[model samples]
Target: MDVRLGHGGSMFFVRDALRKLTLLSLLFGMAFRAAALVPENVVVLYNSSDPESEEIAQYYRQARGIPEGNLVGLALSQKPQISRDEYNRTIRDPLRKIYEDRQWWELGKNQSGQTLPFVNRRPVLAIIRGVPLKIGGSPLPADFKSDPDDPISKRNEAAVDSELLLLGGLDAPIQGVAPNFYFEGEKRFEDSKLSFMLLISRIDAATVATCKRMIRDAIQIEKTGLWGRAYIDYSNRHQMGTSWLNSIQNECRAQGFATVADRFNQSFPRNYPLSDAALYYGWYDSSVSGPFLNPQFRLRPGSVAIHIHSYSAAQLRDASRNWSAPLLEKGAAATVGNVNEPFLQLTHRLDILNDRLMRGWTWAEASCAALPVSSWQSVALGDPLYRPFHHLDGSGEEIERDRDFRSLVKLARKNSDPGQRLKAIETLAAKQKSGILSEAAGLEALAQGKRGEAQKWFKAALVEYQSADNQIRQYLHLAAIARHAKQTKNAAGILKSGLSRAQSFPNSAALAEWLQIVEPKPKPKPKATSGS
Candidate 1:
């Protein structure tokens, strides 16, 4: 039967006047169907680097329904798993075609290029937790501070920009470079972008706001298959209430599909955390947008597992840390955080095996342990704990106490007993009288270059310094460390401010050293553009 009035098999998706109306008409031919059993075939992803990788490999076989064989190889000849294109093509593609032929709407792929299972089936989640791999195939850019442009961060930024463009401008199929997960969906490639053409039904979870595409549901993914990534899903399907997705309503901008989208009568805004970029093609039914910075990974329907990496309300970290969460959750099977290369290494390995351990059509699996090797090295995670303002000379190395703290972290991984590790952390922590463990942790974190560690310690230390010996020295210590932290304006003001408070205190040497530290690090001039 002809589903639309204008043409054969096609429907209008966007328009200008009714832009405020929640988008409708995506279900021109999509009929709501009951869910079924899990799909056959699966894709495995990895984010591991140790014995646990093999252990996860074993667990998927025994605990999860996957058989001992059928696991394909990734990361050939390289230390880290580089790409998984071959495995997806051979394994996941055939399975997706099965569902597409069946027209499973709920668990099926959406118009905006999102993957959801038939409305009622147990979705196959490709776990990628313990498979550890190197961060990127290419060397990091120079001037790349560890926190700025790492693999996950760069990808996240790419996603934000992609969603912005895709809401009304998803011309390129794939937006940025990403893990190739889509095996069988209609592959659309333009200017190096890739996209999987899928159909999105008009209805979605009540919690998903109206307007725009990118509707998804949060599912609690377990690792009954062992050492795979464990994720907490909060998409349009469920009301996790962790965070709010942004929604912007921009009327008919510039996507070539503007005419095609006129059927829905709603113009999507270019908002991140609000919509997915692939929706401009008019397939997604949900309102949330996707971060499509990388190349569009056009996976076929009913292929391997599909997981969306949205957060619950009040669960986001500071700008740097939280940005990488979605990438790891969706891409890697297992991941970890560290003073260096936190998310990619561990999760990469886990996801690989999770993908490998798929059964042709299996029952549901449970979540895995958060980590096989819980915390690795003892790295103070906050500002006050790591970056303490010691009155040491320029030659100062890390304090011995800090060294012991690191040892305890390593022991957490090695120690079999959870009670013992907790005891050890307590024993080390007992040495400090800084009220809460957070103060010492703040100083230690600062030493490691985390953003807020110093400020936390300063607030704590300020209270104690009224009684400490040589109050001026303590004040100078805070000011000096602030300089290295790149708070030039704050450091200068703090130094000048400290003088007023320390008028009668002895030992002005600390004050002089602080003055020296603040003298450098001037702001650079902006580069001239060609037009200017």
Candidate 2:
């Protein structure tokens, strides 16, 4: 099967099948080229003074089949944040010494007369729970002056993981940010000249148990692939950020991933019916809120949820505080956050991260590629080696084997024509009784301005949907269609019925708000009283 995808003015063909013999050869070639960073190339670092750190490290090593000798322990501060002096003395210097002693890398001088790592044996590092999370209060030398206009250049505080990326080049200045040599690079870490720089990610969360669960979820999900809806919230506050999210939302829809996107000014409201969120990307919130605030809400296992904030990862041990910790507590297997105020331009690009991960890049590789700078604020939390979509290698075997809603949607997208695509999806949805597919078809119709078709699909989806949250979303979609058609009464009726069904649900608040908007009560007559 030859699948053609149209992008801009170009058409790209994806060859999924050929003659049996040729197809077998192609599969072998793809498999040979898909070799990623192996367990042997990873080193697990843990805090020697913290037992939980060692426990998490050992558990991860066993789970990922990493060699036992790869686990390294260092005596480090247990606090979430440490002083610059404490970081250099207890963490940085000690870890560098251990790397040298272990012959992990050989240092050399670059053409610019700066020290660099030319040969590297271990390029991946996993910092476990119990290790200090961020470095605090590192001031530049008094003799060194920085541009007053560039505030980012004057800050020196950093995430411990970010600072460690410069481990191979100790001579590099700590102030401001260092360009990540691997950022947007096509070559794999081991194949690049800057292999000396470590691809670091932390396996830490709000608690030891959550950290362990994250590790387990990553490994398990890699076998089957992460599946479910992608929730993208666009704040419309920044054009660059909004554009990035728009790209991500489009890509998710094209690839048959069920996606719900909010393009409004406000963030997803509290008690929003966000369910089965397998991938979430939103921004500008200081802490976790929205559906995440609902005590019963939890992300799909192995889900990657990221909320861009200056201090998203300021403190990972407190679940109620920043975005990272609370998201982890809510069962997100992987997330990227900033330990401090990383300027918007320097933070991880969510679109790049999603695109890379979908292309089967490891968590560490995707995270590093998305980040434009190192020795800065971002910290990626998850199993560093996790590849959420490793199973979907374009072989078509996985899709055929699973035949699930995600696969069906992917197959339907092979049709480039919008009308044909919707028809294909509707056929598959009916054949499989998939509420997700019905919902996706409705969204596609709505995007094409086919309000009547969209309403039918949404009504079908409402009946097919099993979860109350999903059903409520369908109601909203149907009501919006009715309102757009100037059938206010119809819209009100739909919302009222949905509200009646949603009374016991946490998301009922949204229904009530919509009801007030569509069908407000009339003001009482006061003329008789005035006359008296």
Candidate 3:
């Protein structure tokens, strides 16, 4: 009787243990599913190298309904100085500036006497780089003059200190702008573009990285810098109307800085564009603190800051005088009251932000001059689907991959003719040797929110034909363009249309890839609504 009782008790304990294990398994499965849905935020660094950047930003912004504040703009000076080969050592000349008689900072500190609540609200930071050469009409401070033998050692110290402050080394992102490009213009030179290239060549990647870090760390907001990267440099001035001006308005609006757009267009009363730069204009005459606050519409002539990108002397004078420049263009001069002059003028300035500005001469520049280093970047706008590298690996395989992609990219970029670019891509598609499969998937992902499935298909396709990189690249370009219109099905169709040709000539090496993207059964579909 005792042995039977013991056996029955042991069986009961075993049954209880199994039930607990099942419950634990169910809980863990739920947690894993939840983890998969975790969302992430992406901050795009952009500047107007092409129209697509802004359009891409806007399309995403509107499509996703991200708050205006989420899509921010960063400021940079893009002035050309000189062009040099990649290997040649280059020297960056020191920019000089001396404001006469006017204590601009003091006036700015206490201007309008009304209010600057907004300025205090937002953070300000600075970024400084390059070796210092001199300081204010005197020897540099003694504290930093490590080289006693150098005659200008004292001068260099003060300059160094100023540069450090400008770079916001202390992490106080209160105000950061390049004194050279911010106050003056780019230096006058024989060939502006060539000069700019030379200057940029002198700037080491370390200095750029330092500046980028400063900007990112200084912003008080949770999000770091989301400024367009293209406009960050002082050499690409032509990209402005599309990148700079419009970004000013968009970022200002997003940051809760402005009420009226006119405040941005109007020139300040006393020729002070720098001091009066603000985020927004108030109900009557008040302005908020941010990028759009222009003390004077035009900057001082021949100054290092504006020298890179200032309008003509006559244009500057007109802007400084009282915002009286002819707002009309040759095509629209006939339309009088019908045309809103301030808006039109502002739009002209803002037009720099639009990619369409690159339509005529720019199309060629973008097509031919632009260089893509690898297969992933070979597409005109640079789709990273072809090459599987964010940074080059420098391996033998990587070198070969890089060279092959580079050739294809050069092939695409070498032609300014749109028809030729298409023809080249189509010809490769017929052979199916190498191409961009991920790009097609990216488009598909954008269209139907079936990102995983699209990714699977792209990976599978690439696995099937890594050798034919060109065909893959063309399909990727098509995907980027289609993402704007919310045509997921059409994007998918592009893949299907070219799939047969893409697979014909496959890579003998590389493994077969498999993936399927699916949404949660789409909530079992709703019942149909019928007419009553």
Candidate 4:
């Protein structure tokens, strides 16, 4: 089945719609309380061996208003990777001692009688850039045998950020992943029984400047709200992964976020023009590729872009390698990656991550809640306290400014019948001359096999769209419908027209490439045949 139609699968019934409305009301009615993450609850760790690390820590403290005493610097290796012994000796043990000395956590014992920190005072830890990124080369204890059934469980390699989550329980075996106590907990992090487990995130990137920008961007964008399109690339390789991306697509649309979902085996090609990308979730790419390769490509400020791969966060200082740092370099304020080969199931579940963020959870809260296990490979990067959707909890002017989006959200929530929803959206689009609504209606039409209606809505959207990139996107949609119908000439004509209109846009080059794909230049006529 076509991905477009697949995504637009049957809508909920009236009962489901009412239930969803009740859920939304409850979510919005709950105010952010003291249980929410605060600056006072964060302990900033920096590499005392590196001046830059200290500088970043201080900078973040000032930006987020964390208390100066909360900042702790540790003398440690500046390399991106460190030995597990070095991690335990330099990073883990010393930090634990500090927590103990300050009485940040109350010591207790688990069922195994291993002493650990059970009650927490400060529960969030922000690791600075200069700290080592991951641990390597740590052999298991001599008496410990490898798990025969789970080969991957024997690997002791892990991300330093992930390892810190277990700072309270260092005596526990670190050979296998530990089940996260807060994986899907309904209570807030501070309110949950596992509040002792630290919520750790890294404030590191390829460069100090980028790290500072990430910190500042998160603080600034949270004021107005992060608004724009969501680009979801669904690599239809496995059912589990595909379902996750599919849920993300539905959630984005239901929330009134303009979304583009690609259902191709490979990531979007380099020439694909992706604009206004405030949220990105994709997978299976080893390194950064596609539109991100274009120097002009940049995510909107405070964007949360994530690409799932085994080694996507293998290192943080090199933007040319892996997905996380490159995404940070390209203006994403937050992202998630794995420092080692975290099996597919162990990696961040993007659907859950997106849903949590949308519900106004902090970056750290959302990241941890989405993961099934910790003490493994995942690393949450960016300001741990960032709540990108906090504005959604209020009836602020920012929400009023994007009235079309609000209307669409209402349309989605109030109408469960797919046909009725599309019709109502079309009516609203016409009434308000909203390109966002027109485009959404067009997508819904295409999903229902209404090609002619889709074309009409796309044309209307092309006229109403304000941004050149959005207009170009409408043209591409129209051309795709024509091509699918075997109207090659019509597709070529649409592309040519779009190419002309896009000349002044930054995405013009990408649009031109699309034109070439739809209508390649004819081969030169064979040289005059040799004279007979």
Every model's TM-score: 0.26, 0.86, 0.22, 0.85
Instruction: Report the candidate with higher lDDT, 2 versus 3.
Output: 2
| TM-score ranking of the models | 2, 4, 1, 3
Candidate 1 residue lDDT tens string, 1-532: 0112123222122112112121222321223233222222222222234343344434443333443332323332223222233223432343354434443223445564545432422122232223222122234456544433222322211211111111111122221122212121122111112122111111111111210011111111121111111111222332211121111001111100001111112222111111111111211222222322222322111112222222210011221122222222222211222222222221112222122122111211111111111111101000000111111111233443234333333444453354444344334445643322323333334433553644555555455444322244335436546655577778877766665665343333344444545665567999988974
TM-score winner between 1 and 3, please give it: 1
TM-score winner between candidates 1 and 2 = 2
The regions of model 3 sitting more than 4 angstroms off are 1-398, 412-416, 429-432, 436-532
Q: For candidate 2, what is the lDDT?
A: 0.78
lDDT of 2 at 133: 88
lDDT string for model 3 (1-532, tens) is 0112123344343234334332322221111100010001212222233233344444433433344443333222222211211001221111111011211011111132321111111011111222211121323233542433322112211222123212211111111111111111121211111111101100101223322322222121111111110111112223332244445444322221111122222222221112111111111112122111223232111001111111111121122221111111100000001011111111122222122212211111221122111000011111101111111112222233234333334443453453454345434433553333233233223233454444554544455553453344334434424433466566555544444455553310110110001111245777899999
RMSD to native for every prediction? Answer: 22.2, 9.8, 30.5, 8.1
Off by over 4 Å in 1: 1-56, 59-92, 97-122, 127-517, 521-532
Worst 10 residues of 2 by lDDT: 12-21
lDDT of 3: 0.23
Ranking according to lDDT, highest score first: 4, 2, 1, 3
Clashes of 4: 0
Instruction: Kindly list the per-residue Cα lDDT of model 4 for residues 1-532, writing each as its tens digit.
Output: 1112112222122223224333322221222122347999899999999999999999999999999999999999978898888998999889989999998877765555556665677889999999998888576778876545444546778888888875764444567666565676566787765634788889999999999999999998788777777888887766777888988887877676667776646567564667768799887778998778888778888999998787888888889889999999999999998887776666788888899998888999999888867678899999999988766544434645456665666676677677887888889888988788888788777766798898898899999988887898888788778867878889888888987887777666655665666688788897887777
Report the error of model 4 at residue 340, Å: 1.9
Stretches off by above 4 angstroms in model 2 are 1-36, 112-115, 394-403, 416-419, 480-493, 513-532
Go through the candidates in order and give each one's C-alpha lDDT: 0.27, 0.78, 0.23, 0.78
